[model samples]
Target: MTFVHAGHGATMLFMLLLLLGAGAVGAAVLSRRVIGLRILDYPTGRSAHARPVPKGGGLAILVVFVTGVPLAQMIWHHTPTLADKTLLAATAWLGLFSWRDDMHPMPALWKLGAQVLAALLVAWGSLGILPHDGTAWGMLLGRSLWLVVLCNVLNFMDGLDGLAAGCTLLACVVTAILCLHAGAGVDTWGTALVMAVAIAGFLPFNFPNARLFMGDVGSQCCGLVLGALGLHMANLPPLAHGWALMPLMLSGLLADVGVTLLRRTMLRRPLLQAHREHIYQMAHRGGMQPATITVLAWAATLCGAGAACALAGGVIGLPAAAGGVLALQLAWAVVVIRRVRHTPGLRW
Candidate 1:
C-alpha cells in the first residue's frame, strides 16, 4: 500500500505558493469582474446578507485548482490513475453548471442532476481500483450518493461570511495531515493541500466581510474535492475500514446539515428549499456575530480533527472519538437552540 512519494517538500511548497498567488490574484480580479459580469446574488428571504453581493467568486478557486493540481502531479512524477484524473475532472464538470446557475438560477432538479453525474464519475473511476467484490456495485451507488450529499452539505452550510470557506480550508488541512499519517497517495494529500491554499487565496474576499460569495460554483466544487479525497483515503490500505474518520473530521458540518435537514423533514418543510434554520443561522439571528460564529465553527472542526487523528493513531477507539465529536456538536447545537428560543422574536 506504499504510494511512490510524489515530490520533495520544498518543491510542493513552491507549487503551493504559486497556487496561492494565482488564487489570490484570480479571486481579486473575479471579485471586481463579477459585477461587470452581472453575476450577483441579491438578498433573499433566506439570505443572511442584507445587500446584493457579487457571486461566483469560486470560479477563481475552480480555475486555480482545476489547472494547478494536475500540473503539480505531473511535475512531481506521480502519474495519477484514471480515478484520480476523474476526480479532478468532475470538479470542472460540476463547475460549469454551477457557474451558469450563479448567473441564472436553474431548477433544483437540474443542479441536483449535474451533481449526481459528477458524483457518478468519481465513483466510476474509483471502482476501477477498488476491490471487485460482491459489494463493489453497492460501493459505487453509496459513494456516488455520498459525494452528492457532501456537495449539498457544504452548499447548505455556506451562509455566513467565511463559514463554508473557512471550515473547508480547515478540513482540507486536517485531511492532508491524516493522509500523511496513513501514508495515503500523493494524489490524496496533494489534492488536499491544493484545495486548502486555493480556498486560502479566496478567503480574503470572503471572510470578516465578503466582497464576493463562492456561490454554488465555489461551494459545490469544494464539496466534490473534499468528498472525493475522503473516499480516496478510505480505500487506501492504511486507512481502509477506518472510513469513519473522514466523517468524524467533518463532524461539525455534518451535524449542522444533518440536524437541520431532519428538523425540516420532521416539520414537513421542503427539503430542497433554502432557509435560514441551520444552527449557525439560529446563532446569527440570536445575536451572534458572523465572525464569532465562524471562529467557533472552526474550533469545533479542529476538535473533531484532533479526535479523528487520535482514532487514526489508535490513541482512542472509534466509538469514543465518534461519541466525543457528536457530543461536542450536540452541545453547540443546544446552545444555539436555547439562544434562539430565548430571543424575544426568534424561534427554533
Candidate 2:
C-alpha cells in the first residue's frame, strides 16, 4: 500500500512540475517581440479572433512534454519504451512544419502533406496503425485512416480558445483512469497524467479571450499524441474492447465537423474554403459569450468522458453505459446546433 501511494504521489508531483514549466515557457515565448519573430498577425477570412496574438504556444507544451516525459522515466528508473521514442520523433517533425506554418502562411497542400508524413512516421515508429489481432492489410489501412482523420479533426476543432486543450484534458483524464483500472503499466497512466497536467497549466492563458493560442503547433501535436495514446490503450491486454471509447470521447468535435461538412456538401459549398461554420463559432456569434460556450462544451465533455471511464473501469457495463453516453452526446450536439441556428444574427 505504501508503494502504491508513493507511485501515485510521484506521478502527481511530476505532473505539477510539467504544468508549471510548460505554462512559464509559454508565457515567456509570448513576451518576445523581435524582427522575424513568429506571431499571429491578425484575423483572416478563416480566423475567429479579431486581434493579433502570439501563436506557437504549443511550442511550450511540446517542449515541456518532451522534456518532462524523459525526466519522469529517469526518476522512476524505467527505460524509455519504443512508443516514447516514436512519439518524440513524430512530435519533432510535426512541430518543425507547424512552427513554419504558424510563422508564415503556407500552402494548404504543403501543410497537409507534412501532416500526412508525420502521421506515417508515428505509424511506422510505434507500430500503431492497426489492432494486433486484425489482418495485416485491414489493420494498416484502418489505423492509417484513423490517425489521419483524428489528427485533422483536432486541428479543425482548435477554432476556439481552450477548446482543444480542455477537450484533450478530459480525454487524458479518462484514459488515465482506464489505464490505472486495467493495471496497465505505469508508463501509460503516467503519460496521460502528465499530459492532463500540462494542458491544465496552459488552459488559463487560453480560455475565452486568449493571450496566446496553441496554433497549429499545439493542436496537431496534441492530436498525434492522443492518437498514439488511444492506440496504446486499445492494445492493452485487459482492455479488449477499449477502442469503443474513441467515438464517445471525440463525439462532440467529430459530430460538428462531420455534420458541417455534410451540410456544406449538400449545399454545394466549397469544402476547402474556411468560414465561421463550426458550431462553437456559431454559438459565439449568437448571444453566447465565448467563455460561457467554452465552459458548456467542457462540461459536456467531462460528463461523456466520465461515463466512458466508468464503463471502462467496470463500474458500469459496456453495452448500456457507453451507448447511453453516446446518445446523450449526439442529443447535445443537436441542441447546440438548433439553438445557434435559431438565434438572430448567427451565421453558419
RMSD of each: 3.4, 3.9
TM-score for all models, in order of appearance? 0.92, 0.85
How high a TM-score does candidate 1 get?
0.92
Q: Which one is best on lDDT?
A: 1
Worst 10 residues of 1 by lDDT: 1-10
**What is each predicted model's overall lDDT from 0 to 1?**
0.84, 0.73
List, residue by residue over 1-348, the lDDT tens digit for candidate 1: 123334466676676567656655765675666646666788988888999888898888888788778866775678889888898889999998999898889999999999999999998897876647768878888999989989999998899999889989998998888888888766888788778877887888888998889999999999998889878777766663467766887889999999989999999999977788899999999999999999998898899888878887778888899899989998998898788888998877
Q: TM-score for model 2?
A: 0.85
Deviating ranges (above 4 Å) for candidate 2:
1-38, 128-134, 315-319, 345-347
Candidate 1's displacement at residue 57, Å, is 0.8
Summarize candidate 2's per-residue lDDT along 223-342 as a digit string, tens digits.
888887777787786764677666567777777788778888999998877777877777766667777877777776777676667666667777776677668767766767788779
